[model samples]
Target chain A: MEALLEVRELSLRFGGITALSQIGLAVAEGETLAVIGPNGSGKTSLFNCITSIYRPTSGAISFRGEPLTRHSPDEVTRLGIARTFQNLRLFHNMSVLDNLMVGRHLHFRKNLLAAVLRLRGEETRHRRRCEEIVEFLNLEPVRKTRAGDCPYGVQKRVELGRALATEPRLLLLDEPVSGLTQEEKEEFAYWIHEIRGRFGITILLVEHDLRVASRLAGRMVALDHGVKIAEGTPAAVQRHPDVIKAYLGE
Target chain B: MDLVESYAEDLRFARRPAARVLLGLLLAALAVFPWVAAEHLVFLATLIALYSIGVIGQNLLIGYTGQISFGQAGFLAIGAFAFGHLRIWGAPFALALLGAGALAAVAGVFVGFPSLRLKGPYLSIATLGFGVAVYQVFVNWEVLSGGRSGLAIASLQPMFGLSGTRWTYYVYVLLLTGFTLAAYNIVSSFIGRAFVAIRDSDIAAEVNGVSLTRYKLLAFAISSFYTGVHGALYAQILGHIEPQIFNVLESITLFVAVIIGGVASIEGSILGAVFVTLVPKVFANFREMVPVVYGVTILLVLIFEPLGLFGRWLKTRLYFQLWPFR
Candidate 1:
């Protein structure tokens, strides 16, 4: 399959300190790839660089062979890349449903005039689409709940639900299983697999737990101190001496 | 993937027939207000309605979009002057009112664009400058605003059968109701969702494909149009105006009205307008206590009810909903 996303020699630096060094990653169409690393492994930084939240000091990111530069964050999302923040950046003040509606914002083609005049023809259609996503995630119990008021695991799901509402082709999940209980993690992993099975979406996940990462991801790339140390099957990368050293710092 | 549920069906509130009846009756009473009430009281009601219209705009920007504007009165000034001039030139009231609002919307774009990247205190300062500049324009532009003396607008009575004072109540009420509903529609719609999302988190908003620059400018445009229309009507009701009428304090008062009424509630707009308007009358006997009362009221709201009148109203609703229990 053709690579959906390609990163060439990606390097990010903050003043004198480096966050990522000569990193390269390729995600093929409808494939699940995992980036596993210890703290300061540059996983989150890699996602930021792709999203252009922080422009890489050196490197190139291409989506379907198209360079992703000069596009704002919203533009990037509109280009079919949606991501979740590691810190669960849901709209805390808004309800879970409204948070999903915010995800549908890009789908709206009506201008301000059509909106102010109370044109429901387009709006109701979009709301129905959003409701489908809500049910898909089994978030009906907390549909009306404020994001800030929900439990951490539920908030994470809501964040995922929100990212899903945007109809993304590539979902950059930043630690989807973090803070989740064992059962919750299993259930979430199930959903993640189903997301690929059902929607054919390419997922580039950043994860901390090895078992969960290996379970969900078909392949793994391990980073340590901002450098790529191992790449292969999850089990193979897990046993790589350099990766072990990076995780243990031994 | 088999799920077919839609919030549009589930989220629809059961039709409230009685609420509509009550609103109709209340509007009927307001329509007849000028004839039944004392003429002076009718005039006060008209002013209050106009202020309510302006307050709705102010609150939408500050409360819903999380954008701050310290100089909303600038839009009002633009509306007032534009409307006044359009009316004097034989333009009809409806067209002139819309034209005035459009003029202000353009100014909103001008102010809103450069400040797209600006947020919080910096945005506030930019708005403050805008307000100051508008006031200065009114003061210095001799031909446009007739300078400090301001120009006399055509009386509402001769135009559209709205007798400057009494008959104009119906017009004010009509505009107030229409704009309030429009504001409600905007808030309930996805557009309002976009505004609130930006208010909640600009970064998240963009990530979800909400263009911050577009929505930020939109909030300013919609907000200023309302305030501008109110300003136009204010000139008509007052029958005369000067640059001093819409000073910096006037802008601050409008901002405060939104806060005390309810930051994000539609009903809060009217409640805030009425409370803010009546403050001067309730304390008309002792003018010195006016600011004290205003300051104390805001302080009290911040302390107890951070969401202002709307927050208190929600709490009351929940209490009633959970009545007969602790």
Candidate 2:
């Protein structure tokens, strides 16, 4: 498969602490890639670097063929990349549907004059799109409910729905199912699998739950001490000595 | 029995018949108020309308966008003086009003730049400094504001057979209605969503494709524009423009109105305006006690109704809507 996202020699440092050192990876088109690591292994750091939330100490990140390091976070999203937070970051006071609508901000006309005139055809079109996502995510029941008032599992789904609303070419989910119950986990995994087939978009996820990660990801990269310890098929990466050592300790 | 069955229904200005009727009744009352009420009452109503426009603007920045500004009086001063100068140059009334707003909006953009890096109390102090600087300029610059002695304004010329306080009342009421509608449109649109998102979580907002710099600045410009127009109307009402009129105390009064009314609420803006405008009139005999009353009212509201007056209104309305269930 052709690569959709490429990272090379990405390094991030804070004073004496190196969060990620010379980390490199590639996500191919229409494939789900999982980055598995222990706490503080820099899984989130890699996601942040690609999303332009953190400027890498050194290295290059490209989406399709365009360089991404110099762009701001909003600019990166405009380049057809969208992401979810490990801890849900839904606009708490806004309704669930509004949260999804915010994802379509870049696509809106953004003309102040049009807004004042109440020219709402474009708003309706976008609302329709969000409604569809709300239906797909089984959020129809709480569509009008404030996001902060929703249950945690529901908020998580709202976060996913929001990312999907952006119509992104590449979706990055950071621990999408970390706090979910086992039943919710299975449901989320099913959605993750369906996202790949239904949306036909590349996904890069950082997951601490190895079982769910391996189940959703066809290929896996393992990280230890901010280093890429192993990369291969899920079963092979699971069995690799380095991966085992990283998880179970030396 | 009101149900929003479609997106369009949800976005309607008055979704239910009851609301539409209430709005019609309110407009009818306002239309007849100047004729039926005493002149002093009409004057007070006009003041409320003018301050309402400014309060709404302040709410947009502090409530919706979560940017604190104690320098709003500075923008108001700019608008007042801008109008005064424009009128001196023989500009038409409408042109002078708009020019004042535009000029103040420019100043708002400058003040907003500091907000890009500052937050909370630090941002408030920076804005406070801006307000003080504007006051000093108006005080020292004789050519502009006529210095401390002040610039006298001529009474507005009547049009369409209206005159004096009635004419001024109509103009302010009409503009107030227009500005309120525009603010409503802005708060409901994607731009408004971006503002609220920044307030809630700037990090998530940026990642969701909202440029923090752009939206933050837009909030300041729009907010200041409202205050600027208010300043022009205020100058007309007072019949004088002086540096002391737009001082730090004036800024604090506007800020107080936003807090006492409600944060992030449209109704709160109007309610807060009424409270700020009428409270002093109620205590006119005990003029020195006005600040004490304001302090007490704020404390009471903060303690009992943290969401402010609008939140209390919502609860009351909800209770009535759900009557017999409790």
> Which stretches of candidate 1 lie above 4 Å from their native place?
B1-14, B158-164
Worst 10 residues of 2 chain B by lDDT: B146-155
**Candidate 2 residue-wise lDDT, B1-326, digit = tens:** 55678888788777789988999999999999999999999999999999999999999999999999999999999999999888878888899999999999999999999998999999999999999999999888899888666877776897889868899899889999999989999899988999999999999999999999999999999999999999999998888889888999888888889989999988899999999999889988998898888888889989999789998999999999889898
* Model number with the top TM-score: 2
Interface RMSD of each candidate, angstroms, one decimal: 1.7, 0.8
lDDT of each: 0.87, 0.92
Q: Write the per-residue lDDT of candidate 1 for residues A5-120, one digit (tens) a residue.
A: 99999999999999999999899999899999999889999998888788888989999889886688899998899999889888998889889888988998857666667666
Residues B48-117, model 1: lDDT tens digits: 9999999999999998998899988789899998998998898988899999999998899889985677
TM-score of each: 0.95, 0.98
The CA lDDT at B34 in model 1 is: 82
DockQ for each model: 0.73, 0.82
RMSD of each: 2.8, 1.3
Candidate 1 pairs with clashing backbones: B156-B162, B157-B162, B157-B163, B157-B164
